[model samples]
Target: MAEVHTVYVPRDTTACSLGAEAIAQQLGRHLAMHSPDCRLVRNGSRGAFWLEPLLEVETEQGRLAYGPVTPEQLPDLLAAGLLAGTTEHPLYLGPVDDIPWLRRQQRLTFARAGVTDPLSIEDYRTHGGFVGLKKALSMTPQALVDEVKASGLRGRGGAAFPAGIKWQTVLDAPADNPGNPQSGRKFIVCNADEGDSGTFADRLVMEADPYMLIEGMIIAGLAVGADYGFIYLRSEYPLAHQVLQEAITRAEQAGWLGADMQGSGRDFQLEVRLGAGAYICGEETSLLDSLEGKRGMVRAKPPLPALKGAFGQPTVVNNVLTLAAVPWIIDQGGQAYANHGQGRSLGTMPFQLAGNIERGGLVELAFGPTLRELVEDFGGGTRSGRPMQAIQVGGPLGAYLPAAQWDTSLDYEAFAEAGAVLGHGGVVVFDDTVDMAQQARFAMEFCMVESCGKCTPCRIGSVRGVEVIDRIIADDNRAAQLDLLAELCDTMEFGSLCAMGGMTPNPVRSAVEHFPDAFGVTPESSAGAA
Candidate 1:
């Protein structure tokens, strides 16, 4: 065995803050001058924030883990033969894969995530990557869509729509008619505007495995007969944007992108576009508007993005995770990938475990994992180590469930039945310290700030909702205010144009229903609307 060894460190934005890059550079220098056998591989984050700058050393015991390393300590550590003793570091003890949080993950889309050097084609190839592209090159487009359908994968982005159905719709659309009617251009738009708080999965994937997204888009283009693809990214993720740009350049130069990819007749090209910090842009049509350089506003449905999107063309607009998962599904057989999940939800979901929680990180799992397991076992309870009171599943649009409902499964339909949503799989845990009324008010304030003001209920209703919450909290006209708020929420939910208006009441309603004491409102106070 070589006296020297290789180390893997995360480079995702979250990991970088914990000093991942500096650690990698220091380790590399040490390997170059002092230890000829030692090498270092700068890898994408493993999605574990607290253990960032995590060093995974190749050892007889497997990949030994140590983390949150700083560059200044390299010399003494290197001199001590740290590579030889994998368990010596305070953070080191056992194989990283065997760690309970990591072990529990189903890891399909994220199979190569924290494990490989994301940019190196050689590294990716060595780890069973690009096999999907190779297999896809051998099959026809229709056959490819059929394979996806067999996999039973749905969009991991909030909606949980069937991915294969969207592909088929675009493939089967009517061609542009010259005189009487004509088929429009086919497009594949990747929704990378991940504006939800407590959710960084999309940004993590783009920063860590940019090539995967590009490869997935290329495969989608081939599957849907589309020549052009666009990734609509949020401006907040500057590092992710930069990383993706570099990856696209690398892939294009490597014959993985651009016209006539690898001498194959497929003429697919991809480009990245930045969104001007609009939360609604995460929605498909609003994303299209931002791509076209218009204000990000929700548009009507019926002619879904699949039927008419991006300049009135047949297009497939999917989320970052949804698109990133494609290459893997293609490489592996559909049944092989589909066999992991339960019920209507299939395959592993890359859930973003964040906010006021211990062991906060990325957790990829099959659909049936109960919220209780995610919060108690994986999250390890609240960050304050206090008993948790409420947990919010999904984004701001999601419902706040009291601890009694923790047993509910994480699937989309199950969450919907429980008056919640698995929107982008962001689970935020709040301990007893949390004020439910304040959280409820913050939801409305977020909506008010983000609402494009295109619709009456959302534009006017959110401000009123916040005022009503304030009135209820102040204990003045409490009963009338509570009644008014309920009536207002019902109006916005039923009369609003899009989810922005419709679902904003979820947090408010749940807070009011579950913890009425937080609002300081009596039962009689809810009797009449002011």
Candidate 2:
């Protein structure tokens, strides 16, 4: 007869790292002993990572939030009558979305994340979960692809290729025949191997609202005429993998995925294939190779994946964010989704603000915000309150940007024009204490460690690159070493098999170009100084 109030806590990896699991246990013990009428629900993070272990209590007013909680604070919170949803603690953050940090931006793909119980199918539908998939069920396959095309949604997994274009290719390709199993069968794969530094969007999606991804993949399968799909998740994210496995089992039982999807009589079989720890596996072709029990190496592209992929079948490979975005595009017409962001870069970007920053976390906004706004305003500047020196847009392969270039727009084309690429929307800030020369050297070192060694340029050149940078750092003929470094980067950029070696030069070159002072001389004075 008594009302059972619900409490929400995040099981997100970032939140867990901040002792959310321990905090959750303490809350459970405290609420049971003190407030027996309350229930705790472990949800995903709300993306404001700085305020992790955020607790949201259901109230007539709304879900009131209190945050960055630890196990030690649970007793005090209970003593303060926190379960009544009227706690006046200093750490309380009124309402979750009303928090200026979350309210300012757009969140399309991540609509249900941190809000719904990850594995609860009923919870998912209650919060606008299956609307996209239900919409997709009515339209013809070509019509669905066209709707996606009209949305102008590019790949969120670094390449920025149009998702509809890839789907159209697979749709046009032949379907699986009895005699030719590989040629006729089409495949849909979600590239969940989020190995990029400072990037946790993929992990967040999988861990928090996995059914959204399942729905997206099923929609993609229906559009591309594919019955089989797999989410190639990396091994590092144990929590994501476990959550995805449980979520898939739930969907299979609930008829969201399997031989008969939602009684539509259509088939979309989904599986989760774990990836080895090789960063190179994040590449689409390399991912396919790894999925097939082969050594994870880049495949030649004459016969494209659209025509021949995944055991020599026509396949559609999309990033988790790219596919997860589909449900929203379908539910809210493509034009509506298109109306949000700036220019050709349409829709919201879940920008991961990370590394040595003050208020770092995931901030999803439309594509117009400049780097300065992201680093300073949303991020609250550097944690150390030091002069912000440089920032890396995108992942490890992305270029390092100096303070002079902070005004650059976060648009993909704008970044490309400036010798940069928004590779998966990771922005890592570094203060004045950083040594550009050393950072540049680490770029090459990272490439060497992650390279599949499929090409001579990546394998051999990376070694030579480290040697040349050591020479530059030692001031042993710095002028010649600089020239050698430039030449080596050019070789790797043009000669490498994949982006692994090709884009490694992005950070190295940008560091050398922007902060010449770190290298001990300007280009104009290099020879004289040497």
Q: Per-residue lDDT for 1-530 in model 1, tens only?
A: 34537777778888777676677777777777877766677788888776776777787767877655667665565555567754665656468888777887888877777788778877777887677887887789999999888888888788888999989998898648455232556889999989888799998889878888887888888898888999999999998998899888888888878888878877788999988878999888888888878888888888787877887778899999988888888988889878887888888888887888888899999889899998878888888988899988888998899977899988888888998899998988888988999999999999999998889999999999989888888887787787889899999899888888899999889988887778875566544432
lDDT of 2 by residue, 233-313 (tens): 999999999999999999999888898788899998989999989999999999999999999999978688888889888
Mark the regions of model 1 whose C-alpha exceeds 4 Å error after superposition: 28-33, 70-80, 177-184, 522-530
Worst 10 residues of 2 by lDDT: 521-530
For TM-score, the strongest prediction is 2
Q: Give the clash count for model 1.
A: 10
Give the lDDT of residue 370 in candidate 1.
92
Native-structure RMSD, model 1:
2.3
TM-score of each candidate structure, all chains considered together = 0.95, 0.97
> Model 1: clashing residue pairs?
4-37, 132-331, 175-183, 176-182, 176-183, 177-181, 177-182, 177-183, 479-525, 479-526
Q: Rate the local accuracy (lDDT) of all candidates.
A: 0.83, 0.88
